[model samples]
Target chain A: MKKSINKIVMIGAGNLGTNLATAIHKSGYQIVQVFSRTSESARKLAKKTNALYTSSLDEIYPYADLYILALPDDAVLGFLKSKKLNNFFMVHTSGSLPVSVFKPFSNKFGVFYPLQTFSKNKILNFTDIPVCIEGNDKRTESDLMKIAKNISRNVMVLSSEKRKQAHLAAVFACNFTNHMYTIADEILSRKNISFDLIRPLIQETSEKVKLMKPALAQTGPALRKDKQILSAHMKMLAKDENYKKIYSFVSKSILSKTK
Target chain B: MKKSINKIVMIGAGNLGTNLATAIHKSGYQIVQVFSRTSESARKLAKKTNALYTSSLDEIYPYADLYILALPDDAVLGFLKSKKLNNFFMVHTSGSLPVSVFKPFSNKFGVFYPLQTFSKNKILNFTDIPVCIEGNDKRTESDLMKIAKNISRNVMVLSSEKRKQAHLAAVFACNFTNHMYTIADEILSRKNISFDLIRPLIQETSEKVKLMKPALAQTGPALRKDKQILSAHMKMLAKDENYKKIYSFVSKSILSKTK
Candidate 1:
């Protein structure tokens, strides 16, 4: 592979990879090849980026300087085991995994984690997503930052530890919050109440967080410690042990934090 | 105060009461009196709505067409105990409380629960709030619906049973979701990370729910059943018992829901 980190090879055609590659290609960067174990998936992303598709590792283009292993954590680790390719500037887009996972393979390895959840069908505006960059060398760092900064308005250089911590926070903010919505859907559906009723409140809650701290933005019965209503809600979820436990646990947690 | 439903007497100037009264006043209704056990609170709301303020029960306006007992459920019940209401169309704003709680005091008793979380400083656009109306008589129900519909775009005529169920759902959608944000804030702050990083994600998650079922919109390690990342997150939160318990419980709940 060339020493200049311009022509790129992308590994993986998953949600994150597809979005990342598409964004990178849109930003006037060259995406030369897209590789996935599944040929259809590889072709899907490759076609969008106008890159060659391959299901075989041996078919990975040799001239690309930037090799993005935007694969799953285990896949990234497994790929590392093969002692792959030239001394290219390689990186993985993982939240929990440390950047050091690349140290053994290349002299300049890095993390280019996109701090946003990617789903199959959604088209997220790149400007709104935060890109987290970490690297083993300044050259790698700057190159990765150039790519990330090119694609997103929000870019932060966080250590793997800090990135991992941020990822944990995201699980709470995004994952747990989505689960709460799912639970709300379950409760309302059982009662024939549409989820449409609460979407405004949910969106407002998020909008409030933008203007103030989430701690300050927090509200609802739990913050007030309205035990009567809390108990009544708990009773309403009695048939579902998971829902009941979640309700009490989060309500008490909010009370503890606010108090 | 007059026999016409144009005049309203607002009781208990708490968050809901304050917002409810303001929305009603803005919709061209005359708020004759704003009452609270605390003179300061009553005065605060009264000044905003151009209504008279009073702390004493005996000073309540005698002829207002509608009396909104916007107090806590217990306070609402307590007010009903003293037989203090004049024969005005009385209603209490409570989610879980039964509408019949006012039946003993007035022949035209009803419930006017706005199904949205209210805060002291936030200006809620009543146009987005879903007001739930229940009444002892058709006239009371219609009157409550007229006022609710005038101020808000969403109105539901639900019985106490259905309102309670929706209230339970609201706890999950609004209360639990806010707590999730709180937990995310705590996690990030411990590492000195700004909560700003997650705000966009939170907003997007909520927005996704508006277009699709929350169950379909759900993403993250929990839904993917990524055991490694899940365990890693749980370990990251191991120091805080509350967080650890919540992480595991909610993760399992999401897993179950997705499966």
Candidate 2:
């Protein structure tokens, strides 16, 4: 039988690090050490997780069962290459990076990518966050899965390639979707209209997709192919060439989705 | 004080018509008649509101305090010109069309646009839906505002020009936003990943905007300006030229928002 993941050391006290470490700590696992480039972030997360704090990776507790590298994507590879691998398991919480990044350091490594956006100030409930996990070996996968299950109910043993695709999908759904709202906010603010006026509509649009496929939930001049209204809307954006291009291109794309 | 709106004639039994009529009827107003080009649609909505149903405009009950034209934007002007108007107030539920569309038909006309997407089968709560009301005259404005307030808690006496801009903003926030989800769904389905995996992320993105400006809430490769990941994502969409263009263009737009 594989040993259960008990003691953890969280590296990089950024947005994801703070939330993930706190979650693991709350799930009855002991977070042994919290590391960050800045002592303030390290101390802040360490206090929250009831763990020891360090500003340097050299000072990370060597005896922890798992070390979670929650640093930025670029920092992850260099950090993994430089660190000496012990018998303990290690994982990085990134969607785009593959599990093989850990191959140079150790075979007892995996990935624990929670597919959600994190902000330092925002409190998160990890109970339902979809944590995409992958391991280099069966034993590592099982251990990581157990630890992931303890924190999130929605844990999937996704492949590295699939994790990359999920990350891309999220860029469109979360990032591009938020950009659409930013454009709307910009348009309204131009006329001195409050963003609150569209908040209910925004809430309903997101809520509608939860109940049905977004393709089916779509409604607007674009979907209707109402040229008059579409041209009028385009004309309104004539002064802003970038917005007009977006309006035209996205509208055509949406039209193509019509059955 | 203006006369309180009580009796209503709902023309068009489409999505917006059904939802608006139901909400107004539920607010204790009498829906005198429901009109639609399709007899079945008229019958369906009429039965729901306990009102008379008619497929012909000539058979419409004309004595109601208000006539709500919830028809498509293009159909509104033609229908207004074809029908004879009495002294009773009339309003069309459109975002893009101006209140001046009524001046060619009747001086007693205005606009009562509820800024939310509607589906025929979906039940809606009008309490918080933003109902933008515009009137040709002071008396008409008061009557429409009273009628609007009864159905929705969020009512505004907006001008026609601002209403058009609000509608434009909604095209971005609601319609284009749904398209972004559609793109994400397409990408995930290509890899056989269930859209369910991203639902939590989609929900959190929307919820974040409610708390903060979408610009501030933005995350992902575009916001991070991670060149490696951005190019990686763009390469993934190489097969679909349309999607690839959107990925590149939208990423540039997102990068522009960084301040």
Candidate 3:
């Protein structure tokens, strides 16, 4: 058994940082400090969590047991390179970055990736969100796990490589999935159709996956190889070169799956 | 006031047909007949619905008030062309095919498109699914509405042209969205990672659309114009031309939305 993480210093008060800080605070842990190059973001999250805010990396409270770097991927690399890690355990909240990036920078390191899309304005209960965690040492892993378990119900240990692959997979599951919705919104808005018409369909598509694989749930002209309807759809998209390319590429990909 | 439909005949006992048969039956309407090109499917749905089954167009009960052509678009056209009207109202359960397709055959015609993804193995309540209806006459529209209302709480009138556009949008929203899941599945499976890890993310992405525009919910390397990460992701897809093309096309589309 490991001791619980009592004080957390949050770094990079972006969407993930702000959300995580608030969730951790609500879960009865203290967020001792919040840091961001953007002063407004840092101060905003700090006020919410009742933590000290700083725009300087050097100002992070040294007494905090955990530091969550929740900046963008490039910014994460920059923050790691620019700052010297105190003796605290460090982790990132990115989906894509490897834990190795924190290797040479911290005496205690791990990853604390929350596998969900976070928007700054939206408040979510961390209870059901999966938190994928990894650490270089057993105590570090358990301490991180303890922190994760305090805020989330679904925390699991994952290796750096597995987490990277999971992150790549997430690019499709969340990022590309939202991109598809964006395209649908564009198509309907052009026709003056309220996107409200498609909301139930969107929800049902995701819900079905909880019961079955997506490949089995797929139903459309592309999967059916209905050349007539596919051609009609392609012609509809012909006005936009980029959308046409996407339609063709994804249609062909769906067709290839059957083979 | 429009009289309620007394007896109904179902065509195409595939995914949509099977699901609708159950819903209509559960809604206290009589399914007089079930038709399918495959005898096994026709009998399977008929046994479940306690209706007569037929693989032949000639065997359809001519007295049923509503004839739901839930078959494929081409199969629908083929069924219409091969058989003469029995003086009953004809409607299709397709999003793409126009109501005009039924005009050439029936004295009364319309569409009864349920705007939800359906699977034969998965059962769903009709209460929330949007039912898009259009008919040649007021009575035809109202009769379809009665049947639709019996099975669903959401029933609205839409023209054939608008329904076609809505169907096109559905392909992107539901079809392409599921394909994104398939792509994610492939990516993780290659690394022997369980897709269970991403299920929460998938559910949350869809849930976000309920609260905000999907375009606003978008996040990833492509949207941020993070060149290094985007390049890294693109290289990962280099092994498959189709996927690489899709990744580039969608990424550029996302970038365009910011402008």
- Candidate number achieving the greatest lDDT relative to the actual structure: 2
Ranking by lDDT: 2, 3, 1
The full ranking of all candidates by TM-score, starting with the best, is 1, 2, 3
Query: Lowest summed lDDT over 10 consecutive residues: which window, candidate 2 chain A?
Result: A79-88
| lDDT, model 2 | 0.89
Instruction: Tell me which residue pairs clash in candidate 1.
Output: none
What's the DockQ of model 1? Answer: 0.77
In angstroms, the error of model 3 at A35 is 0.8
Model 3 agreement with the true structure over A9-127: per-residue lDDT tens digits: 99888778888999999989999999988999999999999999998766768877788888888988887777656455889887677878887777788889988888898978999
lDDT of 1 at B68: 91
**Global lDDT of each candidate:** 0.85, 0.89, 0.87
- Against the true two-chain complex, what DockQ does each candidate achieve? 0.77, 0.81, 0.81
Model 2, range B177-235, lDDT digits (tens) per residue? 99999998988999999999999998999999887998888888887778889988888
What would the TM-score be for candidate 3 when compared with the true structure?
A: 0.96
Q: Which regions of candidate 2 fall more than 4 Å away from where they truly are?
A: A1-3, A84-88, B1-3, B86-88
Consecutive 10-residue window with the lowest summed lDDT within model 3 chain A:
A79-88
**Which pairs in model 3 have colliding backbones?**
none
Top-scoring candidate (DockQ):
2
